[model samples]
Every structure is written in structure tokens, then in C-alpha cells.
Target chain A: MKPITKLTENEKKSALRIFWGQLRKVNRNVPEQDKIKFLKRIPFFELLKKHQLDEVARVVYEREYRDGEYIFEIDQPGAALFIIQSGEISVEIPTPKGEATQLAVISKNAFFGELALLDESPRSASARAIVPTKVLALFRKDLDKLNSTNPDITANIYKSLATIIGNRLKATNELIERKIKAVA
Target chain B: MSGSERSRKTRRIVVYSMTSIFFSILIAGIVYGLQPMILPFIIGAFLAYLFKPLANSFRGPAITKYIRAGALLFFVGSITYWGTTFIKASLPNEREKLQLKVRLQYRLNERYLSLMNLADGGKGNFIYKTLGQEFDELKKRVIDYVKMSDDERKRFLILQKEISDSDHENKKYYEYYLANLKNQKVDIEKLKSLAGSAIVAIEKPAGDDIGNLANIMRALSHWIILPLAFIFILLDKGQIFHFFLRLIPNRYFELAYTVAEKVDDALGKYIRGTMLECLLVGLTLFIGLFISGVELKMAIIIGMVGGLTNAIPFVGTFIACIMGVFYSLIAENVHSFLPFINENNLMIAVLAVVVIAHLLDNAIYQPLVVGSAVNIHPLVVILSVFGGSLMFGFAGMIFAIPTIVIIKVVTETLFAGLKDYRII
Candidate 1:
């Protein structure tokens, strides 16, 4: 405090500007290698080889969303698959009673909107950023272009997509069976 | 808003404004520096973009990318060389005769138009009087030909003999006289009134001097810049794409990328398809004209024009037909290598050629290449063409479709993105 008082008027103004500038944070640049490693951890891309993962990482676009911002809404045309890079996303659907129901709270390293990669269709549910989040978006068009250029990688992504979807269907079936038994 | 939040927003706005201004200046400077070659650069870039898929499809090692590009360059360069050589050989010799034909065609068109006006509103009586005077002169000439002196008759015979003896196209001196004599068989009993409706007013060939800046730029772009630009783009290993893509900030990256990809896909197919379709149109026109007994030079010019202006809907057909008519009007007596052709039926034949060319374009070329319409409103299409022509002449009109496609894709995507991203 004493040192600041001793400083000249112009110097004090400069110091304050510097302090405010410091408060204005810039996003840190994540290396492409880190993106590839994170992509490898996703079950949806488990079938892809290291080189294929690298290609995907290179093609994916980084997007930032503020807390409570909707990434996409229900019935909106989905053209891309999104993977969480940081923070949280809430995947939600509307109930019959006209109330909003949270289907899942997706955290870092999780993925959503996987159906869009296979075909362009209206999204089944809405995905919104639960907190300030960064995401890596893999657009279907880019993926398709990449697939077209390399046939081997094309099959891998589809294989993984099918497996994950199949697993989800089985899990839902098991849940339904357990509910029926409990009701009986 | 709270003071800190408001101050932070104010700071962000200032930074953003400054950044935008700085970038804009940089871009402007770069554009200004490349202004001279800008046309060529654009031509080249589009060519490269259109052909990228083709280049990618060719199987080769990475090094062969350069080789393939070089081979393409060579192929294009050779074609240009051949084309220029052909032009150089034909133009100098044909210049006078071509000029004369054009002048005669222009005067004929002008006379017809004025006669038409006078016929329509009973206006321009002065033109009617001039026609009356010309009719008298024509009568005198016909009579003079009929009552030729022995010496004049001998001279005409000698000239006719010489023309018959030689098999040169320039033997038109005799053919003109002979065709005129042959076609003067207009039946007096069946003569109709020369009403305004009787005259078919085709659009005139809007002329400009050859030494214009646009023409020079066009030539430079075609011969030099187009190939260089195309090759550079074709050989790029994603660096060029990444350089531009890197500028997109994190917040807008996904939206920008997706928008760009869509625009690229749309523009690429549209341009390439349209160009190929035009090429086919030109080729068909050339073949049709050549078969229809038109002169080689005339056929080539009209075909080229036909193909180029096909971009502007009916304009190509109009120009091709009118030019074909002009050629037919000035043709030699023994014009057709094919026996079915003659001066009397030449105009019909020319019209038939143009019709066939267009029919081919509609039935085959449009479907096979362009795939389907972009579904722009007809009114919008017309206004865009008009706007483009107003700004940059015929080239603008040709470029209008692709420009509209880009705009449409970008606008639609950005609007959707803003809504879906909840940025608005």
C-alpha cells in the first residue's frame, strides 16, 4: 500500500490497467496430442487406431460454451457429434407432463449427439452446458470426407458406433426387465 | 449489469473492435497488393478448388502430388499454346472479311429495325422515305446488271470463270453474285406486307473495343495466372486451409468450420457442373455450325460465345443464333459441303442448330453435371444477374450463381448456429 502511494499518478494508472488486464483471462491452448489421447479414452472411438485417432483429433473443432447455454435444442437438426473436453453438459428431455427431466449429467471425457454422424436427423433430446465448458465437435461432413479419403478408418468408426449403441440398447432392456420383476 | 461486469464487457468490445479493424486493414493491404492479379488469382483459386477432388482421386505417393500437378499444368499449358496458335493463324487473315461481314450485318439490322419502327407506329417516316430511295437505287442497279454492255459482260464472265477454276473460300466474289441471282426467286404473287411483325428483331451483338482493361486482365488471367493459382491450390497439403481455419476463435470455430465445409461442397459442385455443362454446349454448337456449312472461323467464334454466355440463360442461344444468321447471310454460293444446304434454307438451318444445342443442354448436360437446381427463386436469379452485370459486366453475371450459393449457405448456417448456440 505504501509502495503504491509513492508511485507517480501515471504509474498508478498503468498499474491498475495491468491488474485489470491480468484479470481478463485468455484460454489456454491444448496441444493436439492431448486431444488424441482423450479421444482414445472414448468407447465410441475405441475401434480406431492411433493414426486414425490422430486424424480425428486434427479434424475436430474446439467450441466454448458459457454456463446454462444450450448446445442444441430438441428437434433441432443435428449435424455433428460432440465430446466433452472440460466442464459438464446436461442432456435433457421433456416428459409427458410437460416438465423438463434430466436424462444424464455428462462430465469431461463423455460424448453426446453420436447419432448425427451416421445421418442427419432431428436431435432426440437437448444438450446444454451445465457449467462453462469446452468441447471438441466432430462434424459429420468432415468425418465423411475423412472416411471417403481413407476407407479403413471409415469401417472402424461405424463398428465402434454400432457396438456402443448395441450396448446401450441391452442396458435399457435389462433396466426394463428389472422394473417389470419389481412391479410383479 | 453490475459495474465490474459492465466494465469487462466494455473492455471486450473495445478489444474486439480493435482486433477487427486491424485484421480488416491487413486483409485490405493484401488485396490491394494483389489487385493486378486478383482476377487471375480468383480464376486460379476456383479452378484449383473445383479440381481438388479429381486430384485426390488419382492414386500416387505424396511426392507424386507435385508430379500430378505438374502434369496437369503441362496439359493445360499445351492446350493454351495450341489454342493461341490457332487464333494467331486464323485471325490476321480473317480480320478484314470478318470486319466487313460484321459491318454489313450491323447496317442490315439497323435498316430492318427502323423499317420495323416505321411499320409499327407509322413513326420514322424519314426511314420509309430513305427505303423508297434505296429501292429506286436497287432498281437502277438491277436494270444496269440486266442491260450490261458487251465489255462489262465479258469481264463478268472472265471473273466467274476464274472463281470457278479456283477452289478458294475467297471465291465469294462469284458466289455472292450467284446466290443473289438464285435467291431473287422471291415470288411476286406471294409477297407479304413488310410489317413490323414480319421482321424478327434478334438482339444485336453488343460490341466493345478489344483493347479494354478488362479484356487484358481476362487474357492474363486465362494464360498465366489461372494455371499458377490452380496448381498452388491443388498441391497444398492442408497448410493453406489450416492457416485460414486457425483465425477462427474457439467460440466460433465449430460453426465457422461447418459453414465453410457446406459452402465449399455447394460451390464446388455448382461451379464445376456449370462449367462442364457450358463446355458441352460450346462443343455441340461448334459441331452443329460446322455441319451447317458455316465458315470455320465463324463457327468457332459463335460456338465459344454460345458456351460462355450460356451462363446467362437465353443470352447464349440468342448470340449464337444471331451470329449464325450473320454468317449465313455472307456465305458463299456453294457454302455447304452438304447438298441439302442453300442460301434460301440457311436461316432455318442455323435456328435448328441452336435449338438442337439447347435441347442437348437441357436433356443431358444439366442433369448429368449440375445434378439439380439450387432452388433459388426465379426473381432472385434475375435480380442477382442484373446486379452482378451492373457491377462487373458479363463476367459478373457468370459468377452470380456461385456467389449466391455461397451467400445462401453461409447465411443459413450462421442463422442456425446463432440460434442453436444461443448466442443471440
Candidate 2:
């Protein structure tokens, strides 16, 4: 019969060695640089460092939508922020006349559904793919998870999101001023 | 519709249906063939899921994957090492007790045989009666053979020697056998045969080896296979998930992915939370018992059991309480180590400790660890625990709540999706 005491010790040593070896290989294989590059292009993720971006990439999901497919419907619960990787997405709002009015055409490298990163609320407008589109989705649950572990990355993401929203609000204000000036 | 469009839709449906049927059969066959490995796979998957967050946390610039993996390996390895050492230390005492019990059982069987011989009026029982004159003739021939050689007689005497000669108290049965032999009607050969059969009956069962084999299997899986599988799963998590996603038809891929995400969210939180809760409860109870002056070893074992049983919802607390009381009483009666403490005092102390531990668990640990992850009603919790215990015993009871939560989340997501499509 084999000596169990000796066998157990040997197994423990071997398992640790194997695990360390595998972990090093896996770490080397992680595509951190690629993810960092992708995150750098988005305004919300631009403030994040390379390592911070890696943390964000861990929880983000990539999805492909066919042409003419609805990304989300109006008044649906907004739970995730979507960043456009390629192709075009059209945002539409229902007007008082009960007809769809185009809000904005979001193209490659832009993002939509920014409000979801802050709160759990319904979408104000619907977003649909104008062409076959690829987007990265960052959900609130994943964000909250990241918040617990890497608070710096999460805080930076929120800060960038706020800046983006502020910029959009200012642009909208400028457009309204222009419209009012024209009417006057 | 146009003719071309109608034909294309029909062809698409046929292809999808056929592919689904073929894949379903293939998956079923694979599952059936891999039945034995299913438990290890599940265990590995669970560990991978549980540690994923920790693994992800290591993605920061300061830490390398080697360091992260090493930390996890060290943590799990230490726990396993400690647990094995504890079991090893306790095993000798447990084995000794088992041997004592077996010896007592053997003695009881010997007494039973002696009683049967007494009931037969010392005529060597039914076997002697069946043999009749042949038995008498054989006994005489054996006596004659023994008388012919001194060495043969000595050997024959040694053969008839009492097996329990070391124990003075149990020598009465042997004396009774000697008295029966003195009676001419009793055949020596038949008595020897009966004694041999009794010895055979008292021999340890061969089933012990099978039990040991099972223990070895469990140990190997828990310590080796599980961790190895977990590492692989964590390393290839995205690939594995994508592989499953690729299996879905393009039309339903998005919906299926959403459903899977919801299920994963619910089940992951519930499972990880419950594990934390169990650990907290167990540690709290252990500390409480230790403070209350209970024996360290017994307290540790009972506390661990109580904590693990906490996974069974409402019933778990009750079981833990019962175990605490029973173990406390046993310690009180046997060890009597607590000076000037009577049974009532010990019982009261145990009850108070258990109650305080339960309160702490409910008020602090439960809210923090489990939160409102599983929002099932208390009534539903009770029914599920009972149903699970009835169906799958302990494992069922432990898993029932999480299983129900997954079902609830998936069905809600599906219904929501249907509502969005206006199909429900």
C-alpha cells in the first residue's frame, strides 16, 4: 500500500506548482493592450489608466446587432451603457404627433444610453442599428461589482460619464439658443 | 408574400429544426456517457465562478497573474492541509472506538451461540442430531487417533482452545463448550464446525474497503481535480461562454444571452452569498462555544456542522440547535470537565450560546452576506427545504433555494422579453 501521508504532501506541492505555472501562462495571454486601446477611444473610459481599463474590460460584454434591429425600445428599463465599435445606430423619440422623430445618428466610436451608468431608469428614446453594428455593453451590475474591487476605475468611469453628459447638455442649450434667435 | 420569400422562410425553419434535434441528441449522449465526471465538473465550475471576482481583481498593474494564482492556491491549500491534519489526528481514536464496538458485537454473538447450545440440552445442537450414529463413530475415531500419538492429542487440544483466553470474564462460554464435550452424545467435530461458523460470522465485513475507496475518491476530487478544473475554467471562461453562445441560432442569440445573463446574476449572487453566510455562521458559533468553555475539538466539529446546515433555510437553524444541545449534553455527561456544573447549567449555557449565535447570524451576518439575493417568502423557503430534503436528501436541501432563485429569475426575464414582443 502507498503511504498516504507522503502522497498527500507530494500532491499538494505538485498542485501548487501546476497552478502557479498555469496562472503565469494565463496572465501572459490576457489581451490587456487591445482592451486598453479600445477603452481609450471612448470618452467615458478615456480617464481610466491602462490597468483600470483592463478592469473595465473584464466585465464589459461585446454584442453584435443586425441591420434594422432595435438595440433597446423607448421606455424600456435602461440597465447598461452601450459604446459603438463600428457601423451606425439611430436614436429616435416619439413626438407629440405620435410619429417617430430622429434624435441623433450615433456613428463609430460614439456611445449612447449614458444615463444607465448612473441610475436604474427607463430609456427616454429608442436606439436601433442603422447598419450591422458591434457594441460593447457595460451593465450596472458589472459596474457595481467593479466598484467594490477597483473603486478608482469605477469612480473615473462615472466622472467621465458625467463630463460627457454635461457636454451634451451644453450643446443642446447652444442649439436651443440658436433656434430661439432664428425665431426672434 | 413573394414566392421566393415564402420558400426561403420554409427552408430556414426546416434547417433550424433539424439542427436543433441533432444537437439535442448529441448533447444528451455526451451527458449520459460522462455521468461519473459530472460531479467534479459541477464542483469545478462553481469554484471557478466563486473565485472569478478575486481573479479579476488581480488585473491591476501592481499584481501579476502568478502572484494572484499563487495567493489563491495558498489559501485553498492551507485549508485543505488543515482539514486533513485534523481528520488524521482524530482518526486513530475513532478507529479504536470502532474496534471496541466490533469486539463487543463478537462477544454478544458468542454468548448467543452458547445460549443456543444450552437450549439443545448439551447434545451438540441440530447438526449432531442430524449426524446421529455417524457423528458418534467419528468422535470415537478422533479419540482413538488422538490416543495413538501424544503429539496428535496435544495438537487436538490446542485446536479446541478458547479464542477469548485473553479475557478472563468471557471464559464462561469456553467452559460451557468443554462441559458439552464431556457428554458422550455431543460430537466434538460438530461443535468445532459450529464454532468456526461463529468466527466467520464475527469477521469484519469486506464493505470497509469499498468505503475507504469512496473516501479516497472524494478526497482526490476535492483536493486535486476540483482546483485543477477551476483554474482551467477561469482561464477559458470567455471562450467557454462564447462556445455556448455560438451554439444558438443567430435569430435567438441575443434573447438567449440576455436570459443567461439574468440567470447568472441571480444564481451567482445567491450561491456566493450563501457560502459566505455559512462561513460566518460557523465561525461565530465556534467562537461562542469556545468562549462558553466547551471542549475545543467537539465545539469546532459541531460548529462546522451547524454552519454548513445553515444553507437549508429555516430548517437549518433548527437542526443546528438540535446538534448543539445533543453535543453539549454528551460532553457534559461524559467529560464532566466543567467544574461544579450540573446538567441543567450546561444545557442552559448551550441554549443561550446557540440563541445568541442565531440572533447574530440573522441580524448582522444574513443581511450583510446574503442580503435580499433570494426574495422567496418564508413559506416558500420552508416548503422548498422540505421538498428538497425529501427528493435529494441533504444536498437537495442545500441547493433548493438557489435552484428556485434561478428559475424565478429566468422565468421573469423570459416573461419580460415576451411582453416586449407583445407575444404574452
Candidate 3:
């Protein structure tokens, strides 16, 4: 019981099979229904009714990225918000000394580039896949189209966006103050 | 890395490239085989994309999306049905139409030859004016060199050679006319031959009775496939795009998706805006002509021609003007809304209608519907239209701009995206 062993090829294959099995189960559901449920879980869309979630799902685009592929680059004009469907993403920014800093590691069920939907601003940080990643992209124009059709869902998403931005602002302020204190 | 691993990767690359090549060849072969039946799908896809916003505008809690599509189909179907019935009731019978088609083709051929002769006449006003006695004779006799008796034509040619300019001394056209005038009368002869074969395709407006029922259904079936394709695309719920996206390898997935989105956005706006503007302009002309008491038949034809040509900016306006004045000049029952207007005055009225319609189009319709999306260099427009006409006839000419727009957007986006992704 106390002996340790390296994982064998057979065991690795079985683990991969199980992972794929779970993914297949996720995929086996009618795509529309699955997307509706998935969209409903997002904090931005959490307040949306089932039908409203269904409407939002219509314009959602699915994109997959290879490991190390950059989802977006710093200073690039952002056109869409990308929600991680399966794998991890890393958010990085350049420092004053020209070194990169990892701001956060975003995993499944999290979203990045949300600020793009609000305005045509360039991105502040770069995002790259940490692994083979599948993401659902909701484009800004699509969101505006949804706004015309379902103002309630668009309003809820925007409210969530506002809250998220507000929280980030407060955290950033605290971080700056702490840095100043440490310097003093 | 092991040699085996490197070998295996090389093999994979070869396999992928070979498979891609094979599939491309197969698809091309299939499309070539389906040439006759491809129009419907093309038309369907275009209409589907053009009408998508209208369908999108109708979504509500109570209404499912398909219901909205259905409502749009119903609306369009009803209008088409009414239009066809009106047209059928007013259209001339088969024999009358055939005669009219031949006459129109001949008249057009004569007019074209006249224009060509004027251009070639090269400031020889005396040579041009003596060929006719009346204004009508002026047009008819412009090509009179073609109709002259052999002896008279020979004399006419000799006289022309005597009076010809120094520029003509080097030219072989008059020399040919003088040397072997009758047998080598090629250009006008070729024009007549063309007028024979290219006469409006009314050869079998009412096909043989034996081919009626099943043949009619078969003809309708292909067109029906287009609308069905259109409907399925609208109701596809974005599955067509998803299907394509799914096929893209993970490495190129994001790049491909973004490029496709860009192409779709730009092309869709340009096409939809242009189409809506053309439809409105055509409708205005149709209404204007109808109220002005132009013959129903001529009015309908001119309306359609105006709509078709409206894709070309400056050229389209002048063409529409020429068509309106020409039709009014020839139409027997031409009257006008104004009491003082007669058949001759109707030409001016028609010209007024065309100018006003285009003015309104530029001021209101174009700005309101087309906007800046439809902008292209005039030279580019002319070249593309000519290229399209050379390649695929009338349909290609009509579709050239949209097709170019699609290719331009797709290639530009894909190249830019690939560079950004370091894929190529």
C-alpha cells in the first residue's frame, strides 16, 4: 500500500478514454439544448430566462485553439468576448521593463475580453491557450443584435459586466495602494 | 526525436495534402457537372443572406424564429404571386411577342450600326448627312452602305475614298469596301447574324405540347430547389457555419473563424444594401412609368432593365434614360398625366422621370439603403463588369461586384489573420 509506481501507458490510455467519454456525453446532448444550459451558467447570462438564454445562444460562435495559441494580443482591437468551454487560458501583460507578467490563469466557465462588447477599445492584456482549448465567442455586433431583440437579456449581461468592471477597479486600487505602502 | 517519429510526421503531411487535393478535385468536378442546376443554390443563398436581417427583426417571446421566416416567405410569396398575375394579364401573346422580339432586336442592331458608322465617319458631316433625306431616314440610312445596290454602293465607296482624310489612307477598312465590297461585307453581316441568333430567347415561349406537363414541372422543380435551399439556410440556425468551423483544425480554428466572420460581415452589408437600393429604384421607375401612361409592356421591360443596370452607378443612369426615351419614342399609345403631353412630349416626360428617379435615388434611396458600403472605384466597377460579362454573360455581370467583394474580404481577412497567428 505504501509503494509508489509511475503511471503505465495502459492506465494513461484509460484515463484519456474516460476524459473523452465525459466530453462525448457533453457533446451527445442536442447542441442547442447544451448551449442553452452552458450559456445559462455564465454569470453574465445567469439572470436571463431560459428562452432568453436560447436567444443568446443563437449568435454564439465556437472556436478551438491549439496549445500556446494566442487568443488575442495586447493592443489588438477586441471584437468578441471569449468564454472557455473546456481548457485553460493565460492572461498576460508586458511590464515597463519589457518582461511579460501573468495576470491570471482563466479556466473553464470563465470569460475574458468582456470589455470588448461594451466598447471598441483595444485589449490591455494578451490571452493565450495553456492547452488545446475550445471557447465560445460572443461577438460585439451579435450582442448588439441581441440587444435589439431581447433588451432584458442584454441588460442583465451589461449589468453583470458593470459589476465585474467595478470589482476589478476596486481590486486594482487596493493593489496600487498596497504597492505604495510597501515602497514607503 | 526518433527517425520513426519524423518519418510518421512527414507521412501525415503528405496524406493531408493528398486528401485535400483529392477533395478539391472531386468538388470541382461535381460543380462542373451540376452547372445547370447551380443557379438556384446561388440565388437562394444570396436571397437568404440578403433577407436575413428582415427575418431577424421579427423575433419575439411568442414567436419562434421559424415562424418569423415563414411570415417573411408568405409576405414575399404573396407579392410575387400578385406581380406575376398582373404581368401575365398584360403581357402580349406568344406569336405577338415573337414578332415584337425580332423587330426589337433588328431595331437595336440598326441603331448600334448607326452609332458605329458615326464613330467611323470621323467628322465627315457631308458624307453622313447626304445618306438621308428625313430625320428618320438619317437613322435608317446610317447603315445604308450595307443596303445599297452593288453598283450604287461601289460608287458611294469611291466617292468616300476621294473625300477621305489622310488618317483613312493608312486604314484598310475603306480599301476592303472598295476592293471586295459585296463578298467581304463582314462587320454588318456579322452583326445581322448575331441579331438572328441572339434575338430575345422567345424561340419556345410555349414549348411543344408533348413536353408540357412533366417538362413544366421539371423546369419549376429546379427553381423550387433554390427557394427550398434558401429556406433551409435561413432555418439552419447557424449550423452551416458551425459545420464548417468544426472541420477546421485546432491550429487554424480561431483564424479561420475570425476570417469567415469578417468576410460575412462586409459582403453581407454590401450585397444587402445594393439589392435593396436597386429594388426601390426599380419600383419607383415602374410606378412612374405606369402613371405616365407608357405602354404596360414597355414600362415593365424598362423597369426591369433599369433595376438590373442600377448596379452600375453613372452608366446605369444614362442607360435608364436612353431606354425610357427610346421606349416612349416608339410606343404607340404614349400619353401623359399632363394635358399638354403627347407621344413626342412623352419622351421628355420619360426623360424627366428617369432623371428625377435617379436624383431621388442618389439623394434618398442610395443614402438611405446603400450608404458607403456599396462604394467602389468607377474604373474597378467597369473592369469587373466587363470581365464578368466576358466570363459568364448577364448573370455574371449582375453578380460581379458582390462576388468580388466576397473574394476581396475573405482573402484580405485570411491573409491578415494568418500573419497575425504566424500560421503561414
Candidate 4:
């Protein structure tokens, strides 16, 4: 084992090569390509680069939900953003008459609970799996951890999350305006 | 349910129980057989756990996985090396200081005993009377031995050296006994028997050769095996977790994963935060004591012991305070830092410092560093510490809270799952 300070350029390069080779061998389970593909599907991750997406993949937890299972309840303390990998999720809010009104039927590649990642707030609406669903959850804790270690990647993730939330707010305002116009 | 389904379920249950029992025994056997190797692996796992968040942070576009792991390993290894070197350099000095303090304590005790004998009208001073004569005879023998010819002196010295070398503590006591000898009645046999028993009690068992061998093994494991395990475990944690998940049946994978995540959430934050809190507290105490002119090495040792005990929740602070006071008293009596600073004043200062440290920890550090990691009540923490101590001693007390939190999370999850399945 050569001391790092004493190593020549060639030796350093060979050491790095071997180190990377071992790492790649150990991490053969989660392919970078698969992680990239998964991240590419979610609009909230659109601004992240391939490498940044790989960082996100390292912290993202993949969860599977059976059909008719509630992904999260309305008014539950939100702690993560969920991206659907497969199957549909119904995003619904409770109406004044004590009934659930369907807001949207979110499908694969889409995401929900994006607001949770940006702030420590309760979920505004409930999300339930309409089918057997596989979702990738990127927790706020993991993001905060990432922020300390890799600020660049965390900044990109926050930017992407903000954009997605901004778009959703704009769409909601438009829907309200149209509803008012129709009522008048 | 169908008849075939019922039979299959029963068989599955039986097999599962048998498998669990077999594996438990197998694991126990392996642990017992490889006890010497296990400490390193446990320490490595703990190190890997502690560094996981930091390691994860470095896994971004700029740094490759290998570089991140290597950097972490290098950092941890350097710290460990520096710490061990520091301890090695300071240990002998600390030991000498402690021995000096012990000798002073013995001298003080002997003086107090002599004073009591004089106050009691020396004739009825039974303690002095009984032990004094034996010590006088012992002193006379020593004087005679010293005055003897070369061959006689050599024979006497050989016999005396064997007894004296048996235990350092008893040798100190013997010195006190000889020094305090006076013209008073005594029982030589009884005094000799008492001193002999004390020597026997203090003597290290001959079996310590095996113990020393184990210690050497542990040291090798700590220095070499632990860091390597930590690096490798940090590198492939996700892969390892996935491999374990794959081993679970598909039907149970989600449940197991959820349970594992809950356990991590319950234990990980608490453990990490508590460790950081302890380090901060320990470092603060060390600095405070050093500033107060406490002996540097003794200050470090006391601060460290206090900080490590801080893991046991409520009572740990009190224990640390007691230790602080005890050491401060000893320091004041032995080597007065200043003429104005008497024993009482030093005690008050020590207590005040410890109290202030505790206040700062509770008000500022605990909220920020530890922060609702474990939601157990204060009362529960106290009870659990006692209960754990009673059941499993010191280690239990340290781990009891986290263990309870894990259990709570598991039970709540199980109840929620049961309700979801409409089985309750």
C-alpha cells in the first residue's frame, strides 16, 4: 500500500481505477441507467442532471402498494415527495358534503406530495393507489442530508420541486377562475 | 379456507418456527465461538452506521462512490490514530497522578487513626493497640534484616520482596502500617491474616494470560479489521439491504421493508443525535475543567467518563456531577492550585461548572441536537433505565430507551396492519 502523498500520477490513476472498479462491482445491483430512466419520468426531477439523478436514486426508497390502499391520508404530516413508477393513484380532497371529490387520476411517470419536500406541512389532499403501484419516495430528511454533503445536487432538486409546485398552483388558479366565470 | 390451504398454513408455521429456533441457536453458537472477532465487526457496523449519512452526502456528481468511501475511511482512520496516540501518550502520567492521590489518602487515614488514639487516652485505643504491636515487630524485623551480613540480608530480602510484589495496593497499606507503628498491645497473627486477605483480594488472577491474549486480539481487530469493515459496509449498504430483501419471500417483502424503515427512523436519529450530544457535552466539560486549572489528563478522563455515561438519560448527569465533585476534592487536597482556593470552594466551583454544563445541554443542545428523536416521556426514560439496569446491567441501561422505541414502533405498525386487514 503506497502512501497517498508519495504516490506518483500513474499510481494514483491506477488506484482510482481499481477503487472505482470495486465500487462498480459492489453497486452492480442498482444500475445507473435504471435510476436515470426513473428520474426522467418525473417532472419534478426534470431539472436534475443524469449524475444528480443518480445521487437522488441513492436516497430514494421504492415502495409497493396494493390496489385500493391509501398512499397517504389527507392532513397527514407530509415528509416526502412520491413519484409513481407504475399504476395509477387517485388524488382526492374531501368535499363540503363529507364526500371525496376526485382532483386527478395520476398515472405512471407523474408525482404527488411535492409540497411535502419543500416544507413541513400536512398533505392538502389524500392519495390512494387505484392499482398495484410501485412508487419512488425521496424523503426530506435524505434531501437535507444531501444538502449538507452535496449542495449543488440538493439545489437542483429544490429548483425542480419549486417549478413543479409553481405549475400546479397556476393550474389550480385557472380552474378556480373558470369555475367563477361559469357561476356568474 | 380449503383443507389443503389449512394444512399448508400449519406446515408453514411449523417450518418457520423450527427455522427461527435453529437459526437463533446457530447464531448464538457462532457468536460464542467467534467472540474475539465479534467486537470488531460490531464496532465496524456502528462506525458504518454513524458515517452513512455523511457518506451518502458525498455520493453526487462531483465524487464517485469509491472516492466518497475512501475519503470517509481516510478521515475516520486518521481520527482514530490520533485519538489512540493521544491516549497512549497520556496514560502513564494519569496513572502516576492517580497513584499519588491514593498514597496521600492512605497517609491522611493513618494520621486520623493516630489522632483518634491520642484523644482516646492511648491505653484503651484498641484499633491502635491491636495493629500497633504487629507493625512494631514487623519494623524491628526489617531493621534487623537491614543490619544482617550479606548472605542473611539477601535471604530476608528475597522472602520480603515476594510478599511486597504481590499487590501494589497492599504494599501501600503495608507502608502505612509500618509508618504508624507505636508502643501499643496488638495481635500479630490477626493483623497478618487481615493484610494477607487484602493482598489476595487485590491480586490479579493468573488466568489473566488468557485475558491478555483476548485483549491483543481485540486490539488487532479494532486497529485493522474495524476500519476495513466500515469502509466496505458503507460502500455496499444498499446492495446488502437489497440482497436481504431478496431473501425474504415476495409476499413479505413490503412488510419487512416497512418495518425496517420504521426501525431505522426510530433508532437511527436517536442514536446519532445522542452520540453527537454526548461528544459535545464531553468536549465542553473537558474545556471547562481545563480552564478551571484541573490536571489536563484527569480532566479529559473525567469528561470522557461523564459524556459516555450521558447515554443513560436522566441519572447520568447526576453521576457525572458526583464524579466531578470527587475528582475536584482530590485535586484541591493534593495540589492546591491557589492559596485562596480551598476544598469547599473547589467543590462549589466544580458543582457550578457541571450544573451550568447540564443547563446548557438541556436548554440549547438537547433541543437542537437530539430533538424529539425518541418521543418517550421523562418518566418512561427513568423507569426504563432502572428496569434495564436490573435486567441486563450497564449495557441494558444504555440501550434500554432505544430498544423500547423500536418495540413501540414495531407494535404500532403491527396494530395498523392488523386493522388494515380487518383482523382485530
Query: Which segments of candidate 2 are over 4 A away from where they belong?
Result: A1-59, A95-99, B1-11, B54-62, B77-81, B84-225, B236-265, B291-293, B324-340, B389-395, B413-424
Expressed as tens digits, the lDDT of each residue in B1-424 for candidate 2 is 7798689879989998998899999999988987656656676667778777778777754576556766776786688689889867755353234233333333333333453363344645676567646855754564443221333223334444533467654344345334434543446665455534422225667998899999998766655666677777776536676667667653454456667878887788888898888888888878776666667886787677788777766555676677667555434333344564554355566677778878988899889977967566778767887898899776577567877888888889888865653435
DockQ of 3: 0.20
lDDT of 1 at A133: 95
The window of 10 residues in a row where model 4 chain A has the poorest summed lDDT is A24-33
**What is the full ranking by TM-score, best candidate first?**
3, 1, 2, 4
In order of appearance, the predictions have TM-scores of 0.69, 0.67, 0.72, 0.63
Give the per-residue lDDT of model 4 (tens digit) for A1-184. Answer: 9665688899989998788668655654555558667787776777786656776787776778877777776776566788898999999998899988998999989888887777757789989899999888777766876797768888878887777778879999999999999999
lDDT (10s digit) by residue, model 1, range B1-424:
6798789979988999999999999999989887767776776787677678877777533436778788777776787688788777666333244334333433343344454464345555665566756754664464344333333323443434544446555455444433333334433232212111232436655464444767977766655777888899888856576667767665555566667877787778777787788899999999888887877777888898899877667778889988888666555553776789876567678889999999999899888988763546546766788999899886687677788888887888788877765557
Candidate 4 lDDT tens digits, B270-294: 8888888888878877876666667
Question: Which of candidates 1 and 4 reaches a greater lDDT?
Answer: 1
Q: Model 1: runs farther than 4 Å from truth?
A: A1-38, A50-54, A65-70, A93-102, A129-132, B1-9, B60-64, B92-228, B236-259, B295-297, B333-338, B342-344, B376-383, B393-398, B408-424
Q: Considering every candidate listed, which one attains the maximal TM-score?
A: 3
**What is candidate 3's lDDT per residue for B1-424, written digit by digit as tens?**
6798689879989999999999999999999987767887887777778788888887654676668777777776787788789777767764344333333434444344454454445442554466534644655453343334443333434344445476543243344343332323446554333333422334665656668887878878778877787788777767788788777775565567668777887888788787788888887888888778787667777777787678787676787788787676445545666676675467777888888888989899888876767356768878898899899997688688988887778878888777766666
Which candidate should be chosen as best, given DockQ against the real structure? 3
User: TM-score (chain A) of candidate 3?
Assistant: 0.79
What tier of docking accuracy does candidate 3 attain? incorrect
Which is the leading candidate under lDDT? 3
Query: Model 1: per-residue lDDT, tens digit, A1-184?
Result: 4553488899988997676445322321357767778889988788887666766776776677877777777876677899998999999998889877999999988899999898878799988898999888888987788877777777888888888899999999999999999999
